[model samples]
Target chain A: MKKKLIVKKNFLMSLFAVILGLIAGAILMFVTGSNPIEGFYYLFRGGLMNIERIGNSLATATPLIFAGLSVAFAFKTGLFNIGGAGQMLIGGLCATAVGLTFDWPKPILLTVIIIAAMIGGALWGALPGLLKARFNVHEVVATIMMNWIAYWTVFYLVPLYLKGPFLETESQRIPMAASLKVSWLTSLFSGSYINLGIFLAIIFVAITAFILERTTLGYELKAVGYNRDAAEAAGIGVNRNIVLSMAVAGALAGLGGATFYVGFASNMQIGVLPSQGFDGIAVALLGANSPWGVFAAALFFGLLHTGKGFMNAMTAIPPEIADTIIATIIYFAATSVLIERNWDKLNKFRLALRLRKSKQESLEDDSGGEQ
Target chain B: MVDLIYQLFPYAIAFTVPLLITSLGGLYSERSGVINIGLEGLMLMGMFVGALIISRTESIYPGTAIWIGLLAAMLFGAVFALLHAFACVTLNANQVISGIAINMIAAAVTVYLARLISGSGNIQIIRGLSRQTIPILSDIPILGRLLFTQTYATTWFVLLILVVATFLLYKTRFGLRLRACGEHPHAADSAGVNVYRMRYMAVIISGACAGLGGATFIVTISGEFNGTAAGLGFLALAALIFGQWKPWGILGAAFFFGFASTVANVSQVVPMLAQIPGIYLKTFPYVVTLAALVLSSKYSLAPKAIGEPYDKGKR
Candidate 1:
């Protein structure tokens, strides 16, 4: 019960922190000659005002959810997966290739594309994992280097293999069957391009939450995260856990890629990899590496992104300003020492309050006995 | 072949000078047990700051006073990169995440600040570092033209840094302490070396080096700051890894990468490679980097404790 209360307190503090950050961000905007009220009103309306807007938010959030899960899952297992961008690229291309070349029913086609994406991402991740497991090569270095390799390899191969009607540099579009259908509400905003990939994202989020909280594997992963040496002593295979963590992380990132291509982009067109993977790191961190936290964080980011675009369309502010706000918030968030310092003070205060109350109750009992 | 060499030569030198300068900066930081992933961000900030200062001052030499401004930026980067070091070194925060945070912060903040200063997202051309010709050496027919006819002050500065760093890392006691801290901080600490101080020193040196590299690229090569560092930080990083984290090795690798980069950019002008394949030729540098990375994986001789945080209490 005490542990639950502590967790609740931590959650409330994080909520307060986020609110403070947004307020700070708004003040900065106001000082910069932009009306914070209008800017944010536009941002919120753009994100949630209509069904089409909601669809757009969901579309943006879809890939982020996967990337967040990727980073979060890895964090839970005492590893850091920095190669999400490269893995996503490989997954995107693999899924696109399957989506374009294969001919099958809609369900089978989607399944194949997703599986292919996961496999491609898994292979990208596993190489670094295997290298680390075998050679003690730091996963950070290997994964970062592999990201570069995967990016370039994909960049080089895509133009050679998939150049289509979009002209010289771009890729061919995926087939109709491979594309995801938008919901009825989304269709009401007929011209809007949002799809139903958000449903898949939510489903995955639920599955991940369940696995982490309810499953033995989740317990083992948490154990490894808390203390790898202790987990190893308890008969957990640390190497296996690390590799599996990366593999799962890659698969999630891969699913993100699949959603991006099948639901959003015209093709698997990528001259340079999207910054989605890097953004996912921000998402995961802001969410505090929890499943629900990730969902909320993704939505917040999604709203900010959509609103930034709307602001650019409506006002004089450059869209990049939104990015600045986000970066600042995340930078502050990564200053975990600040959080720890505050928590220490809070704990001390609570301890003192408890001691004072206990003494007063004992004094009352003593007085009653005398009477 | 002569035409291809000629086309590649000028650009090859151009590419190598900036990368060499930057890779050396990375070496300084990594050798100190702090990985400077903010190299790219620092470079971006430097380019903008350097250009703005130069344009405003309107004199290349005095405007070059902006060079000192980079120390401010380096301090910022050191503080910023220290976030990574602290996460890794102190609280045992994942080095990669901390690095990514720096990268994200650097990108966003620099872009925002650039707008505030320039009144636009991009800065215009200013008095860039003009090429200087050596009187006697410039007169030589072929080799002189290739090596001495025209170059930025930074090229010479990079050469000097390489020599000095090599001496510092291998010859000097300070170098020995730095390496010892990186390889085994606890051991270094036991030897009465302040491991934290050494690591901080390494990262600061790296930030300054990276800052200089950023300034050089903006003031000399691009003639303006348009955020065109173009993932050069990563290339420099790749160079650092490919160089086996040694100063001399890094110089050699930077030169090779520079050659590949020049070839990729100018392949259209080189008649022989033009017919071979445009797409393949254009992507040669990244491909080379990828190949080098794969090849290095076969025998990576990285510093023993490259990414691991230093802990005083842990034996």
Candidate 2:
């Protein structure tokens, strides 16, 4: 019952944060001399107006789902994996290399590509974990350093190894044999960008949920997260768990990169770190670090991202308003403690009013009986 | 080698000043128990505001517009940091998350406003600071040629601020009280130091200094606002850590980074540096910082009570 209450409270808190974010967006619109209601109407309509648009939204959300899951998973282990951008870059690089190298059967080629991506990302992530575990180096700093290293590595490698025929900044396009997109799914979405990545995302979400709720490894990781000294006293191999957790987190993000580079986008672009990596942090926070919650939040953000372009085309509002709203939501989410305090106060006030009403009725009954 | 060093000296100093000031800003905040990762966003805000103000007033004010714009940026940055201070100090929110929020908000809002003012989402200034050599100081020796010649006015200003800040932090009662709050807030509170106030002041000062750093970048190197600081703020944060949170250490670290970056940027043209891969030079500072972190882990000088919300009722 207590667990159920906590879950319900989290849901309500998330809802409250979303509403506050929208209101902040509205205020910004108003301040900018645009009609907020009209802008919002067009925004939602653009996202859901047609089946193709819905498919596009889902496609946009595919990488976000994986990125969010990666962040949420690390968060469960009390680790902040801000190196998602670097991991994703490495993962994408690995996937691109695999896709461009071989001309094997479609199924076999894609399998190799995905595994390569995961391994690359895992190796990238484990170094920081190793540093943190052995040297007591802070993961935040290590991850950031890793990010720059990965950036420079990609910058140097892509031009030399993966460059396209003419363009110097991006990789050669992935052939259909290695891509995550299939004809049937494309036809089903009516020429939309949706691909097999969505199914993969769902499967991983379920897997993450199961592992976190029903597995011993998850329990041990959580215990260490809750209190390191206590977990050590309980004989948990804290160092091993930390490294394993980071490797797993890195794998998830690497999978996100695979979906992004081979599934959504046709080519890996150099000199750019994917913004989805940072957006994943917002998604995890707003989702309360839950797997399914991350899924839902990713979809919501995906819708906003997809619709913003249409909104910009139709109205005077710039596309950045969507970003502003998302940022505001994150800010509100960070300050949820203050919201919780107010919520409790409001509940207590309501309870006191109900008690006063009940007492008045009893007093009136007693007076009538005496008469 | 001497010729190359001479050629790069001014550029290195130009890059280092912004980082030095920004890292010192971080030092103040961390010393007061706040972990501010929002320096990047704060710098962006400063760059945008500085560009906007200078672009508007440069024609009218001629010589004084850049200074005015920098001052405005500092003011606005201080005002912006109040949100972080309120969230962390008053509401006791998670400092790291709140800092992230500050970053996101600043990035989005600044771009939104920039787009409104300029359709291209970039602000350009008509003029920027020029390098001026010191009159008497430039004729001394090799040291004078490298240090005193071709220096920006803002460089001298920032160096002066650094010295004053160092003195203020080490030699004053207020600084002692502020450092005490970061180390032991409860004890400081018992001794009549208002922890909340000190933290607020520290965070605000950080914002102002970061703003100045960003504006300095605009006037000295960039000469335009392009909605990003190219990760300089994060580099400064790394320098803060690599320096073990000391003023002199930060200066050295910042200079090391600046020199490395300048070399990387000019590697293709310089015959000696071209032999080495540009990628190595580009990644050197970050790699070295990580190594430093590993080496210094045993003697980490991070503030004792950093990133923790002070709760008087807990202990």
Candidate 3:
């Protein structure tokens, strides 16, 4: 019971936010004259009703898990990495380029592709880090700018080098050797788009959690996040950590990009920076910046997106309205800082009252025994 | 050359107004110790509201829809910004996260509402504002022809806003206190300025300016709100950085972007410009903005205490 309480306390705030988000979504549904309970019923059912849907949700969550980790990892180092979008794009681009050009054995090719994606993303992330560390250039503005640069780079590269026979807006379809999907896995999932990325995401989640919880590096990074000046005074290399943190973030986002372009999608599309990049921010926040929590949050978001179509089809709610509800929930979840502060205050207050009560009871017992 | 000037100058002014006003909007917020990265989202909100009002009420009030829409946009912007103000100032939420949330809300709300009302994502104005030349100014020489001819009344409104904003920023008591709060809120608090109130007011004013700018875009230039300001808000943010948060410098930067946008738009009409690929032309301004940011960020004089939520109890 005690252990359960402690576990609940650790995740209680995030769970509260989730419940509040659901209530907000329900309110929107009710206001729109639909039954909120029914709306949610179908929504969850669509994502989990069958083996195929479950497989699809997990597949959809694969990239989001990486994206969430990317954002969360940076948050631990006192950095707001809004450039995840650009990093993801560049990462995807590199992966696509390698996949399209090279012919090698599956193991070597996949390894090379993943490494290339990580490098591309790391380079993109490192620029903003260097700028912020060296030049005092605000990372937010620099990353926003970098997003556009990546956008145009993909825009130019797609049509110029890897255009398909019919479409001008996307690259050529990645061949079977370059793809992440295998015949046996597809068959097991009954023709779902499930791939190797899900397993990779799970392994990385465990790795990231281990790094953050059990390692000296993560401790130093967290210290930097808590107080940069204090950490600097304590002899931590502040600038190096900032850069290293961002590079790791970028690499994580790059892995997400690879999962997306190579595993889930057959070809790379132009003219869009992936929405998953931005969703990563929501995922990180919702997960309370925990690696395992990010996995769960990402899975939830994947369920929403995967089930969104069913909700639209079954109810009077339009797709745009559904999206509005989700974004509203995100808007509320983004206020987790305030919620966290309040929760901390409440805990302290409760602890203080309990201590006073125990002290008075002990004094009373002593008096009765003496009498 | 004459043809180029004639073609490009008017469009430049039209495009420049939003960038100028939005950056000025950013200036107010940042100068008052609040970092508002949601200017893009706020502008989108104003644009969609203004467009919706005009489109729906064109039949009811054809003569006054545009002006009414502008005011409506401003009102909507203030209300929306109140949410941001509440989050950042009162709740002490992470400013960047809140700003991003505000942006997501705006993007989501506008598209959903537009589709809900218009049965489509895009909202088109029935009649766009026409150009008006100043009566006495039209009779003047080459200067008048270059400046006054074939321009919307919002052009003059933009100039008026620029002057008033400059005056209010530099020459007023409130302005001094606002600047003081941004520089050192504790000092301002010691001097009897309410730091929270000042920051809140500054954010609201930022909203109003962004609203007017967004209305100008819908009323004069685009004649439609397509659920996006086409990233003009981010450009305005770039201008704010490039301008070093000065009014005149912001105007100059706004004009530079405005000219670039005009070049992008008029390339279809101009013979020399038509040779370039459409994609290249589209990407030019964004690339230039990035370059400008990289250069300008090196010398930026941003407010000292900006992005820090002022806590009065902290020494």
Give DockQ per model, in order: 0.36, 0.73, 0.51
The lDDT, on a scale of 0 to 1, for candidate 2 is 0.89
Runs off by more than 4 Å, candidate 3: A1-10, A103-106, B135-142, B265-271, B274-300
Greater TM-score among 2 and 3 belongs to 2
Give all TM-scores, in the order shown. 0.88, 0.96, 0.93
Please provide, for model 1 over B1-70, each residue's C-alpha lDDT reduced to its tens digit, 9 standing for 90 to 100. Answer: 7656754676687778777877887887788677766677766666666666656665545644555544
lDDT per model vs. reference: 0.74, 0.89, 0.84
Point to the candidate with the largest DockQ. Answer: 2
Q: Rank the candidates by TM-score, best first.
A: 2, 3, 1
**Scored by Cα lDDT, where does model 1 land?**
0.74
Residue B273 in candidate 2 has what lDDT?
89
Residue-wise C-alpha lDDT for candidate 1, range A1-371, written one tens digit per residue: 98787567656655754665577567767777888888778777777887777777777888888888888888898777888888888888888888878799988998888889899888888877776666655667677776766766666677878878766556788777887654564566654556656787888899899989999999998898899899999999888877888888888888888888777775866556667788888788778788888888888888787777787677655566566666655555665545667788988999999999999999999999999
> What are the per-model C-alpha RMSD values against the true structure?
3.7, 2.2, 2.7
- Residue A165 CA error for candidate 3 (Å)? 3.4
Measured by TM-score, how close is model 3 to the native structure?
Answer: 0.93
